[model samples]
Target chain A: MEMEKLYRMHSDRVYSYIYLLVRHRECAEDLTQETFYKAYKGLEAFNKQASTATWLLKIARNVTYDYFRRKRVIKFFSFDKGHDLETNALSPESRYEQKEQLARMFATLSKLKKDYQEVLLLRKIQECSIQETAFILGWTEAKVKMKMTRALEALKKEFHKEGGHPNGTIKRI
Target chain B: MEPSKEFDELFEEMKEVERSEEAKRNTWLALKGRIATKRKRNIFPAFISLAIVAIATFLIITYSIPSETEQSAESLSNEEIIRAVLEREYNGPDKEHLRLMNDWMKFQSERNAKNQEEYDELLESKEYKDFMNYYQTTFGEYFTENMLTKAISTVMVFKYHYYLEDTDIEMHLENVEIKQEKDHPNIYRPIIEVSLTNSQGQKIFHTLREEFIFSKSEPGKIGSYNVAKGGGSIEFREKIENFNSYVGGNEDVRTPSFRKTISFDTLCFNGKIFENENTQKNIHGCTSDRKKINSILKIFDHLPIKEATEQESRKRAEALPQMDNYQIYLTNEVDKGTTFYTITLYEDGVLMFAPGLDLGILGDITTAPHAVIYEKVKLMLDEFSDN
Candidate 1:
């Protein structure tokens, strides 16, 4: 496929997926840089497991997951910057309902463990197939299916406990 | 069926909201910019690495050429000569030279009681000539000038042997009369004052009138030396060309033989030189003043022609650790309180880390050490490696 045509076609979808993972515009922008950087570097690795969009989304998913994994590793070791101040989030009404939902999704998702949150986001919201999700997360297909079910159930429980904000309503769609 | 169609409408609306051209361009542009930046970043480091290689090569070439050319003319200081002599004895080809020196010291001591004829015989020995020749040739010209000077000085010493007791041994300058004693013709007595202090700053002991004996004879010109108890005896007779002039009657000189050894009971007591409150305050003040001096000197060291920027100052300040062996901690902003400076000796690596101190004086915050900031990034990398 022509690189420019592929970029034109998939860039919006890629950005949408990334926006959900990192809510802030600046962070989302940075992640998009990392995602494309990864994509360009590993362009030859794209074997036909799914569509090119799915392949790019998978790359974005893994990149985003790796970012969180790095962050968690740092936090776990007490090597991170101190959580000295509360973080700020975007307004719910500024973007469209889906984008807003994605932003809201990130705020809550940031609270969950890296593994559980990654599986849930890729399988549920991005609507990636079980095999694709498994491949992207480097998990077995069966494990992806099992974890996706468990993660959704866990998310439901968490959303209900938090009184059903965007994350709770995300499931109703 | 109609309600299902309405639900499809909601999904279409969701897709519409999710898919935006602006978001796509923003993300693509962001990625494109980063790729450009990554490429740009490599250029500077590549250029810098080449520059460093060129500079390092130049320095090594310059350092090697001069040292090899002037190997003979290189002059060693007294300290260097002492270290070389000590090292030679440590790794001597044969222990014969060592035995000869020890024998000479003993024979010269014993000759003091004998007649001139016996003393003269001792001085003209082949072993003495061999020892002198070996020291002069092995050490080259550097060692001869310094060693000869040191050997001919008058030495005054007070023996405490008592580590726990700090003694005050005073040698009155007025009482320091240099007089040739009638009994010992070659020796003259000069009184000198000495003081000793214990760890607790207590004067544990006191003394006076310690005598230092020195020979007045010209060392290189001395044809022979006579050692005798009664009426003196000539131990050796050798016509040497010239003698070292460190004996007496010349310019003011502090002979190392008039050495003072301050014995300390413990390691804590050994640092008594700096442990004094006055000394502590003096060092603290001196370090701050030196920082300013270094700041001004660094401007010349780095720029040579231009003034320093904040970043330049920061880099220069960081490099100061190499100049002075002290570790500087940028405890606060450069504009704030004095940064603490300490010297740390790491035994494992045999490394010395000295960071310069910044007291925030001179109203120039630009002079703050950059090591404090640069170390943060290193600490982060170390933490990453640990995981």
Candidate 2:
């Protein structure tokens, strides 16, 4: 596929995945660019065994991990004192509540082990198939299923601690 | 049980968080530029080969041009002949050495450029803009132009340092209210509420009530606001039960190690100097001495020490048995608030300095003004020890 076309078709998904993992918008953008750059460079070697989306995502995952490795110690915050989390205007009250809950959920998700986070993000959040997740993560189907189960359980427990009931009811404190 | 339907809804909401059109265009442009650069780099080997051929041709031409003087020059000593040849062909270092130096310089330039790019990107972020907006909205009304700028800059420095080491924590501005002090009607108190949550589900609800004591002469001017006297308290809440105990008792948590320690001799604190127990002495100095001590204390106050990962703490424990020489101490009352620094310098040249245990793992003072502080302390100790 042409680089521009490939990017146009899948860049949003790829960017979103990376953004969720790194939780930094600018870094996500850079990593997305890096992912495409690598894909463009390695386009010839790409075996067509996986879909282009999967291939791009695999590259994205690797690029993000490489970034983490280079910055072995991830800095929690930059030195600029005026930093604040981005906020958008609320339309309906319910939408605002949902957004807040989602933010809380993601914050909990970040606490999970890297492997668990990767699997759940890819399979559940990004809506990648089990096979696609396994391929991206270099895990077998069985391992993906096994890890997914464990990841979900861990997430559920975290949710429960955050006032989320097992029956999917969330009580906001 | 399967994942909840609420999770599906949350995931759908997450999809909405995407790259904007401008971001997409920018990313594509950047990708294209990088690809073009990569293609250009691919031709570097060909250029190098061509250069080698050119050099060979030049050498052949030089060697072929024979003169009666050149013929006679061969009769000189081997070293003399080599010196002459080198002087004729080169003004300084050989081509190979120059090439290596050029490569090293290029590498350094590229790394610096990458760092600058990352910093620029960070400045352009929405979160940074929001932070600036918050400050401007809250303080802009009362601040003089210069005072506002200085206040924002000071706050930015604190925010930057705080966030750099605590990226896992999310900061939310809960509220910002401007009110008058109870007795002092003219004095404005901007009560800012900020909520912070870390990855471990621990939350800190902080209420910063700043007493914006404006000058009587310039009633609402920025310079009038006294920031030095403002203070706040943090209220901790754990979303997860026993989160503190988990973080505290569990030393196996994995934390990043950014600073690396190097060798240093001598140690100094305030007026006391210690090279060895017997060599320790008290020293007095001019006004600049106090300034220097204050600077060192400021750096120590911001040392990036965090709790070691459980695995790291274990590894350290195992290694401690082998580390026979290590010195740990607290500085004498640096101020009235009982503020002191804990410094652990090992025989193997590792130094771990921090203000207190709750702040996190003791970090190496290997970077920047901190490194400068270390050197100054060392020099002070050396001077006193010599005396």
Candidate 3:
């Protein structure tokens, strides 16, 4: 019940973060299960300085990378280079169906340096605080802020480059 | 031209990207199996604790503390059933935490000279650190220090209590409406209404309908699993609506292409239309202001993006009935004199309704918080006011 209670409190956010990283539903769920199992095994190490959400996310991040390591898709330079990074089915344009501009923004986003995408997802999409984002990325807050500015600038340029038009929609057959 | 404003709206809109219930349930069901083994291993410690309690009770008391499972769960009455459900959520370990939080909240919120002095002394006392340690594990979600000091209005307090105890400042369950689906005989539907008086002396209400499926053989149980759905339901249903689909071989898939534009000549916003003075365009407006019309139409270009299902649309309408409706009409071909697209804006929240790419898309609507589209239209109108 204790571990189950913890899962009920924080699994969705953890799963969401992992899904975006892994790009496969089943893979993400497996990673989420692994992260919780790790947390259960490593409960003594939790020093109470961080929120349970924060601690769980740190574990989830590690579990996802460990999975990538096992798969031998070791992407060092482009941290955003996860499975399906280039897939048309999972493009930002298709992911955001409500707003074409948002779809455009994400499309532009995917084109930037992959590190930029990594920072932006944490800062922008996840809505993590700078301190939390820094902790998860194992970078300083100053670096996170600096990277965010550069990423937004690059995104603006990429967005305007395409005239932000020709919005891609998947017509099924 | 305001990229900043555009980005702000898009970022805010990003929050509306929904997660489906299927995902949440599937992940939990799959993970529970692995956890069950760990739970079984934990029983040994409890066995040892029970032995220790037996030895201590002979020295300390005349009788042993009674076993908890004195009665079977099978024969629980309706009152007992509801109690079982609530008891599951507000477990024994959390009751003291809940009570202490409420007391701390009262001290923080309704603080007078007398109460403040007592609390300040308590803060100085050694128990404060022990108290903080006690609550750290219980309130893993909220910032305890922040709750006690800053953040006016006790919103976090209210939210914390609401999630844990089905309570706000003071929550009262008004009623429960029970019904059985005629088509699905074994399924039970309970519509529960709860009202709470917030710290601001205002009433806030929440009503949730949770389905409990009963197997005929099991008289007391409601399905294999149940979760009271009050705390964690997302606004955007993550179920992607079918816009375009066909078949390939024996398998099924879709090739999605993003569309940037849709066509309409006549724009009717909130029952006001401007007629194109030339009349050749067959467009009508409030004052024939094409600039305002263009700006207004620009916002809806790719809009009504995600389609809401009939069930989800109906659920939202019932849940948020306070929203005022404002409908807009767009004519595809004025010569045909038919309304091709329709947008009905609910004032509290924005729900854009439109014709589905000239397809048979009935519920072509997507919701955004705070009537963003309505505000955008108003802003465009103000920009072109002189014209």
Candidate 4:
């Protein structure tokens, strides 16, 4: 059945998607359980309008966002620091060549706010198409393009500040 | 300008990621439980046909029974046969049968109220508490997770106790219960209860009677408990055999709700579970949100004073926000389904036990109904302690 195929194809990807947002292995596991429950319960609502992957992606994204909004708002409302960035381990000496550039880049990206982060992550990391990104984000394709461009431009300016080249120093930050 | 391929890879590398095979398996199992429940609910349509059959049978029996003497035979011919067949049909060595048996027992419980009362009296006797405590300490580790959630419109606290014989093996708690209630149709009020118990029987002390309304995750609400009457003092003491018998059919009940319980040999602290490192890791790992983590730390800030351990201090360090400098440590152990959370908070090198804010959020999410009722009793106890 198509249902079984959808499960085989998307289960891992959906698991990966949720694993990033929750950060805890156990919670991501629980949420993944919940996401699949929603998918199976609403299978009748599939409509075939979107691919099963996209449909499941929407459900997983919604679950992650719900958790983020509920759990993140109460504790980190006043937080300016991105919890994700702290988890990144980069030594200063190794990346001295591009330290300022990367710092500027992150600083700029962080400053632009949460919406920009979503669009950038969707387009660049997830490699979602402009339309797919928009659909996932409930934005128009034009909006996705505009946001992606802005995020990229912001990153470029940071690179330019550090000498306009990556230089392959391979520093950990 | 777009990020170059190299930068993209770098960004990907920065994405902190770790996957656990155990966690994946847990997820799949939970999904399986949900799917099974859904399938069970699919019998709703069939219930209508059953209703019709029952009605027709009742009519025939009523007309055929000319005297009260004929009632027993008709009942035997009808109800007894159905009950017998059903009991036989569902008599497999499966969990579902156990669950049905549990349900049947519950349905049969009204007539057994006297027995429950006698048991309650026996337990309430001072002799019983002493005997239970003695047995718990002398025999082996005893952990109990009684009342998944209690406190409908009042403060709810769940309790777990861990006992050790040789090794200080104890209960660990992992899941928190969150409850949301509606007075009218639209208004939603949230309550919470903490659920922690290890596979072995250790206990966690979560008192529900305290005032615990954290920030209203939703606004335009009362933002506090405003009830007229009928709430307080959720009791956690019950006969284990009876309690286990109630939920014996459900295999899910057998799984340690908490991550792991340390044995008596592993007792990091002198007498209590608050001293274990593994317990601390499990508590922090339970919730991924920094906000919730901070909220938990805030709760820890209110616990009554206790001596600290290296492992305990280390556990608190793990919970500290990377950007902030508040020392908050949480350690817990679950033995036999009872979970205990030992939280120590330090600020600027000072210790503190954050007072009650009524954490009944766990009361909502817990699937167990009796546990919810019991949390209300905990809420009352919290008030008593405050007084």
Candidate 1 ranges beyond 4 A from true positions: A69-113, A165-173, B1-23, B30-387
Tens-digit per-residue lDDT, B1-387, candidate 1: 332132232223223224345766666766655543542322111212233334434544454344453432235433333233323322212344445555655555556423334434654554434443333344324322322222211100011111111222211111122334689653433222122222333211111221223223422221211222321111100000011121112222121110122211111000011234344211111222334333322221211011234564554445433332222232333333443332221111111222334321111221112222222322322332312
TM-score for each of the candidates: 0.29, 0.37, 0.34, 0.34
In angstroms, how far off is B373's CA in candidate 1? 43
Query: Model 4, range A1-173, lDDT digits (tens) per residue?
Result: 23334555666667766654454556667777778888876775578766676677778888888887877641111212322233225576544544443444444445455676677666665556776777778888898888877766666665555444444453244
What docking class should model 3 receive?
incorrect
DockQ score, prediction 3 = 0.08
Each candidate: RMSD: 31.8, 27.5, 28.5, 24.6
> Candidate 3 at B130: error in angstroms?
32
Model 2 lDDT tens row, A98-146: 5456656766676677788888888877788988998899999999999
Give lDDT tens digits, candidate 2, residues B1-387. 566453676556555665579988998888876754553333121212233334434544554454455543325432233233223221221333234334534543454433334434443443333334433333333445444454443331122223223245545544444555678755665545444456775444344444455445654353444432434322222312223442353333222222122212212433344556456544432222445544434444433334444564454445443442233223333432232444543323234545532121344331111222334344444443324
Order of the predicted models by DockQ, top scorer first? 2, 4, 1, 3
Better of 1 and 4 by lDDT: 4
Among all windows of ten consecutive residues in candidate 3 chain B, which has the lowest summed lDDT?
B239-248
Question: Model 3 — TM-score against the truth?
Answer: 0.34
Runs in model 3 deviating more than 4 A are A74-102, A165-173, B1-6, B39-387
Calculate DockQ per candidate and list them.
0.10, 0.23, 0.08, 0.17
Best by TM-score: 2
CAPRI tier for the interface of model 2: incorrect
Model 4 stretches astray by more than 4 angstroms: A1-7, A72-111, A158-167, A170-173, B1-6, B11-18, B42-387
Model 1 is docked with a DockQ of 0.10
Count the clashes in each prediction: 19, 27, 18, 84
